[model samples]
Target chain A: METVKFDLEKHTLREVNQYLHSDASVLDGKAVTIDNPNGSHNIAVGLKADVNVTIQGHAGYYAAGMNQLANVVIEGSAGTGVAENMMSGRVHVKGFASNAAGATANGGLLIIDGDAGLRCGISMKGANIVVGGSVGSFSAFMAQAGNLVILGDAGEALGDSLYEARIFVRGNIQSLGSDCEVKPMDDTAKQILVDLLAESGHGDVDPDSFTLLGSARKLYNFHVDNAGDY
Target chain B: MGTKDQLALVRDPFACKPAIIAEHDDYVAIASEFRSLAHLPDIKNAKVFEPAPKEMYVWKL
Candidate 1:
């Protein structure tokens, strides 16, 4: 269990990566408080340790891309593709996030505390994205498999081309995607959202305010009637 | 002036179009330049606002 404090002068992504890859276990339980982190792209990539990394400032594109087994938390807003293609572990954003927050993510939990830009969780495989704020249009487009939970309003054309993934929204949806439908919340759905919000530090929310969004399975194979819908 | 009025005035580039007609193309160029400004990294610590309780939206996947 090693502790390292990253100042703006001595903090470079290369140095952070080198320390993470070293046998020292760079950030075991210590708080790696980074001051004035001005949109540094790919701040922590390919970290495979059971450690915690907290960035106290805003981050640029793909801040924690391809994370395997590290818990990364960004205290501020994140730019586009914050956790692109992440395999596992958890990434939490405490502020507004840009486009493609968790694109093509295979697994892990991504929590955004503010509004997210367009196309969030696109082509998601199995990752779970929980947004505490509203999302822009075309969210969950071409989603393969995963769960996207929005606690606020969603813009037009939500979940355009969907697979086996499920989306649950607590607010108004401007429009539904091709073959996407609103279904009754089952016990499993309610419990999943309740637990997710609780784990994400949003336990005070009422779970009954949400509505589930998922693929109808009718257009999963492509049909002529759903052509315009897509 | 109220905050909304100030915002409206700040966002009204067309209000001065007649005076800057000769520089209309330059206005477009300046708009592009300003658009690029949005992409620049925040030099200072970006402000973090509390997650709005009522306006918040969530999607569970």
Candidate 2:
């Protein structure tokens, strides 16, 4: 039940990060509050403890990048690469997020309460992402594995060149990407959606209302027959 | 607003392209400068080389 506070407006980024790094293990299972982030890049990067961090204002690029066993909550909007390459734990953005949100993260859950920009979940390995609002184009591009659940509309070329990743969109998708196609939502898929929605605190949304998109397996081995689709 | 000569002079000369090699256990390794490979599954070891600032690192995790 310990609470630690860091004021970014009055401190250097390195100093703040140094304090966090030194105290990460000591303050494990505690609550940390970062005030006046003001779109600072690399805030709280490389955290590996089991704790909770709250950023009061907007965060710049790579906030909570490479996170593991920690819960990071951004009270305001986030810039590019939030929660990028996260190993485990959770990252929640209360406001909108910029491009590349949760890019290449292997595990954990990223919940965005507001809209997300382009390339969300691109190259993700195993993370589960839920967006409460719409997402920009090229989301889930080149994703090898994971689940991206978008409650709102998806922009153009969603899930291009994807592999094994599951995408659930409640609203209209502008278009499908190369080798990406819509798939029927089976009972297992519906159950997964239900669990994801519940985990994201959006249990009210109907899982049946969403459409699933995944890889068409056309570019798996990259044959000359499917060169046009590549 | 600057001339080409001035721009070239000011441009960074030591800017070598950054790259990452993420060798995963059961999946194909990913090599990208734009993407991150820190979260890849079953990582036995890792090595990083930085031309700028001149640093080399090896991590075992």
Candidate 3:
């Protein structure tokens, strides 16, 4: 378990990323530490190995975007689109994340210990996002598939134009957007939320306290009966 | 947009839009996203923070 450390102050982001994007034999199961990120964009992104990477400072846009099989931890807040379009692996933000966090991610887990800004998980194909704090407006908008668990309050239009994705909220929701409505919390959904909470470091929280919100299935197809709503 | 005396950044109360404000010894930088300011010199030591909704960020020379 040798630790590979890179100081962004000395090495450019491209150089550090080149090392991360090296041969699988060099990156697999490796522990990497990046010092002085300084809110840089695209740190630890597109990783394909089972490595653990720690970014010691704040990250800019799309940090760890399109990641796979890696665990990236951001010690400070993230700018925009943290972990956006990820395929697999885990991106954990210890501080708040700005707009579009986890947008369009297909797989893996995104854990935000603090609040997440607007449009979180937008258009997500399949991923698990757990936010310990509140989320801004229009989050989970048009998310086709996946699950978003919010422990704190949600801003306006919490799940606007949502599709098949499920949203679990423990606190109050300012409003539900078009095609988003509360669904019955069945045992299966609760179990899934339980696992998500546990994975996001909230295992002790009661799963039953969450409310499931999903698509009403009214906007998928154009029906003349519901034309006005469309 | 700025003129001569002061520069200002505004965020709507709804906060649908995002803005990041960074201050340094050389200048005060603001952008809708942090990526826009990532390439700036000495950015690693700049004071970075998100602007509050409905607050006016004014810079004086």
Candidate 4:
């Protein structure tokens, strides 16, 4: 496997994305490493490959936006929209993440080892986001599908305006969003979280403390009386 | 009042409390203001709920 090392001290985002995209051709089965990346915006956009990219430091906005079939790992914190509109593969952040980490993603997995800002998976479709720490308010807002597993406390209004997505939080939630309710954690849901946490490298955490959040399906289609709830 | 009377009063169906629809309206307005100030484009205009998910274009701040 070929390896490409990107030293952020001397390279630009344009250089990084170009190199990542181009390297996919030369190093078809290689694992690329971007060493010492410091909050660069759009670092690996629109990359389609079977390679693994390890970013050694913090990343700026949309670090792996629209990624397809590439495993991108950031060793530090990430800014907003880190994996926006991703179609497949995985984006792992070893530390905290900013807002909209996987916004509108159609498919893939996002793993954040630390806390995530608001709307972590807003309008997500088929993307699974597992946060090892707390998630800010409005997480999974209007999520159409997929799963969100929070190993820490979930802030207020969890899963507001949700659609078909499942949320499992291991800590307290300040409030549930309109039409969002806490259902009993059944065996199916519990097993799913356990397996997911394991796959995301958080298998040791306890799963019993988690609560599930989903749409009540009452206000799925807006109505006159339901207007008061919004 | 007797305990039963108090219970009846508590459960009275006709008891009318002034509805604060204005509060809801104000909240909506404030939320919209905040969204605007935060530079969040109105997703209502973008029709995010459409059958086919529309790609939202967002730029870095």
Candidates in order, interface RMSD in Å: 9.5, 12.3, 2.7, 15.4
- For model 4, what is the error of residue A49's alpha carbon versus the real structure, in angstroms, after optimal superposition? 0.6
Model 1, A151-204: lDDT tens per residue? 888877798878878898988898887777887788887888888889888899
Q: Candidate 3 at residue A181, lDDT? A: 96
The TM-scores, one per candidate, come to: 0.78, 0.78, 0.86, 0.76
Docking quality level of the chain pair in candidate 2 = incorrect
Model 2 Cα lDDT, one tens digit per residue, A110-216: 99998887789999999999999988778999999889999999877899999999999999988888989989998888898999999999999889899999999
Pick by lDDT: which candidate is best?
Answer: 3
For model 4, the superposed segments whose C-alpha errors exceed 4 Å read: A23-25, B1-61
Alpha-carbon shift of residue A90 in model 4 (angstroms): 0.8
Model 4: per-residue Cα lDDT over A162-216, one tens digit each: 8888999888887788888888888888898888999999888888878888888
DockQ winner, 3 or 4? 3
lDDT of each: 0.72, 0.80, 0.90, 0.73
TM-score of chain A of 3: 0.97
If both were scored by DockQ, which would come out higher, candidate 2 or candidate 3?
3
Per-structure clash totals for the candidates: 19, 0, 0, 0
- After superposition on all CA atoms, what RMSD does each candidate show versus the true structure? 9.1, 14.0, 3.4, 15.2
Worst 10 residues of 4 chain A by lDDT: A19-28
